[model samples]
Target chain A: MLNTEALAGVRYRENDVRVFEELVRRYDRKLYNVALRLTGNPDEAKDLAQEALLRAYRGFSRFQLGTSFEKWLFRIASNLYIDRLRKQRNVRFESLDEPVPTASGQVEKALPDWSNNPEDVAEQNELADEIQAALQSLPINYRLAVILYDLEGFSYEEISGILRCSIGTVRSRIHRGRRLLREKLAPYVKPAAAAGARW
Target chain B: MTCEKAMSLMSAYLDKELGFDEFRQVELHLAYCEACSQEYESLKATKELLGTLRAADLPREFWPELRERLGAVAAEERVAPARAKFASSARQSSSRQPRWRGILRPASGGGGGSLFSSPMAKALVPAFLVLVLAALPMVWSTRRRPAEAQVSSRIDSIEPYFRDYVISEYDRPLSDKTSVGFVVTGQAVTMYTSDLLGPSSKVTRASGLREASPLPPNTAGNEYTLISYPR
Candidate 1:
């Protein structure tokens, strides 16, 4: 356990720059990952991570020592990502009633080539690609919960803090997200005979 | 518990957050239910597979910029207290030292006109009192000198005669008629539980003497030191 009392005393009273530097260095990578998964873009993740660090630095004085600094920092980063997403309200997804839009609503949707041409199907090689596509297509909230719990290994409590939701919601999102991924990946799951093919 | 309820708690059960009773309920349900067990396994595997996504560390220089920003913020915090102190000191010098105006006038350029203007000067009265509090001990000692000396002289003169008598009187049981003696010094009154042959004492309370009888009530600033009493 991080010595919250000592860290807080040093941070508030000593105003220790090195401690603050260590804090940023410690959380920056995790924060970047969170931002990356949330924004679904590297450049935006980097910007958001830097912004979160700055915000955390500004607000460090008010941070309660001995509590979850990780949660606090993630909350800041998550809120920033949510704010950015809110600002970009034009991010349109395929509504339940609408056809799946490819790249743009006007672009003709490309179906997966399944001619059993061997070269086109590529056996299990397309599984990873499909999973990634399905993940990108997930609603932002479900995607966030899936990434945080599945990829980041955040406890449900930590995810709740990061997502500003109850743990029940986090569990529901994860369960729903996985169910959706399994559904989307259904066609791609190769049969035992088909699995023998070379990539 | 039904499988539905048990499933609702699986996450908490996995995390060991469920209470013992709930844990028992979930455990009993899980033992009987295969479908829920399969769902739990899938959820656990998905959690594991998700955990495999390594967080990509940014370039080495990224944290440096963040640290630099943090350092700047920390430096700002360090300077805040000193800045506040300086501001207060400047405010003090402006009000107390008329001669400081000459120095401030040239510096202020045109902002000096409102320095001594209404409301601000009135506010200076409280600030001036605070500055004077630095010499509070001296003020209290000077005011208390005469009464303190009288008490000391009375103690000295009365000591020789009361030596054995004071000792015998202290032997008289702790009672209401004990007649605790006190000397009024400035705004304070000094009292002793018995009197000198023991140690000097002070009994203070904020409510004047309303409760200053032999028995003391809960009050602020009421403290006693045994002056001197018989052995």
Candidate 2:
């Protein structure tokens, strides 16, 4: 199998759609998962992942050969995600504050129910939901840092490149993000640890 | 190391990203300080829990759908150059005659002979003419309006900076028929000028403006400046 750079080179030099398709096959699942974790919405995740790939194809000519294609691709994805967030910021703010019309009457909108009892978080699926909710609750930058570092397993340097921040900033964000996560998931952490030490 | 210091380095320590001395310090601290050790364990546990969350695979039909979309995109890209050629030919013809006339002339074998020779082009001329005629009045009225006439009230305050230039946030052609606009938000001024200046046009210090940095390249538009002026 050709390495990513070599594949990218073939696609770039030969304009081979087959090689590009191969690249898409390799990355679609991982990209889709990352988008899912970031947005916590499967539909949005699918759209974001597909859009990212389309953008990658459109901008393939600009990609420098010999550089990490993964990072370049991720940088595009992250930037698109950020742009979407910015565009949606006002709509999200307004929707959150606006009263939703119910059958009874228009009432004050309640925030998402993130607080779960320790007992309720016992199931793996429920635990995953809690973790995802906690992850989504974080500010965008910190959430991105944590997702890239811990979830996606990108190195700090690669993350800094993908996020377009300094390595020091990456380190700080990851540390702070983990601390925030630990606080939110405190109720389940101990029991899960006692269940079995997987790490 | 103080607990605060050791705890701050906990993530790096767990990730094996710390230097040898820093790693040693954190290890020694975690070994003795029960609180820090617990904190380290909790952080590690959180990461482990995150890892346990299985990645949801894309639906089975996702690749097929994406492949279809890619095929459509490829088809569009292939058509784009032919469209550009037709447009350029129309533009060249329009320089000598009316734009609508230039467009219709293609059917009469004026330019882009291959493109306009199609049966679809024969049907398009009359429909396009009707549309253009309907839109002509609005176009004429807009063209007659002064370039600076619709400048926003907000831009009036900064009018002194470039009295000669008509500055508007909205996309409007300059008096010279070039699209130019400058947005001043707080201290930063972003100038987006299409056709008037190339993408690489830089702001000289002599222009009483300090170039801060170029913003990230926008995919849809030309790159512009994020500059500030010395008040």
Candidate 3:
């Protein structure tokens, strides 16, 4: 099988559509998942992923060979997502002072205590949803750092390149992002710790 | 290390991104400080919890739609350069001199004589003069407005000019803010916004023929208003 670099070289030199298609197929799942996590909407994720691929094809000539294709592709996707966010001005606002209408009575909105529940399949799904919500609550910069580092398993350096920032910025964002996540997921963390899970 | 410093390095310590001395300092602090240790543990648990969130599979329809779009883009790319070549050649054949030069020296034999004698130029000259005459008031009115208003309106009208350009954006995070720079390929213009999310002042230059100076810093905000137009 041809490596990504060879495939890219062929596509660039020969203008072979088949080579580009193969390249897209290889990264399609990863790109789509990243988009899904970023947008938190399936439809938007699909569109964003598709748009990123189209952009990659159009700008293929600018892509330098022998570099990590994944990073290059992700840079394009991240830019598109940020651009869309800027255009829409879609800042999510949740007031901490607002009272929640619970079944028993009105109470302050707070993170629920899930420390006692067993890690069953259903509970896991709910936990995933809660994690996703917590991620969405963060600022886009911090969210990108956390998702790329913790979820996507990209190294700090890789993230710095993909995000077009220095390693110090990456460190600051990940540290602040995790701190915020810890605060939000404190209830879940205690239980996982009690269950003897190592970080 | 102070607790504040230890807490700040907790994430890096857990991720092992810290250097030897820094890592040792953090480790030594965590060994003695119960509060910092617990904080570190909590951060570690948070990262672990994130690991449990499974990656969802790409939907079946994604590839099909993407393939269709790629096909359309390919077709358009094939046709675009030929069309541009024809247009350029037609323009060259019509008049090699600049418009202003032709207007100033109509009797000059160097591409100006044939241009003024052409039937198309004969009709276009009257229409051009009429447009300039009609636009005089509007131009005067626009110039009379505040310079800031003119800049805002120019930024708003930038979308139409970008139709033929391919835009690639680079976002650089400043110490406390984000600045976005847009590189437009296929055209000689480049635009820079000092702030990404606020009412930013952008600098746009079109091939060095015309350049708009950046607006005053006080009037600029961090949010940029994107101008959208239908293709």
Which 10-residue window in model 1 chain A sums to the lowest lDDT? Answer: A190-199
Q: List, for all models, the DockQ compared with the true complex.
A: 0.20, 0.24, 0.32
What are the Cα lDDT values of the candidates? 0.64, 0.73, 0.74
The CAPRI classification for model 1 reads as incorrect
Recovered native contacts in candidate 2, as a fraction? 0.49
Question: Per-residue lDDT of A25-110 in model 1, one digit per residue for the tens?
Answer: 66777778778767666787888988887887677778887778888888888778778778878877564444565665654555
Off by over 4 Å in 2: A1-15, A92-124, A191-199, B85-231
| Candidate 3 lDDT for residue B65 | 84
lDDT of 2 by residue, B22-59 (tens): 99998888777878777778888888878888879887
lDDT of 3 by residue, B66-137 (tens): 888987777776678779999999989767766677554557454537456667878998999999999999
What part of the reference interface contacts, as a 0 to 1 fraction, does candidate 1 reproduce? 0.36
* Residue ranges of candidate 1 with Cα displaced over 4 Å: A9-15, A90-144, A160-170, A185-199, B10-38, B71-231
lDDT of 3 by residue, A101-181 (tens): 889999987766566754665566788888888988889999999999998888899999999999889999999999898
Which has the better TM-score: candidate 1, or candidate 2? 2
The candidate that wins on lDDT is: 3
lDDT-wise, the better of 2 and 3 is 3
CAPRI quality level assigned to candidate 2 from its DockQ score: acceptable
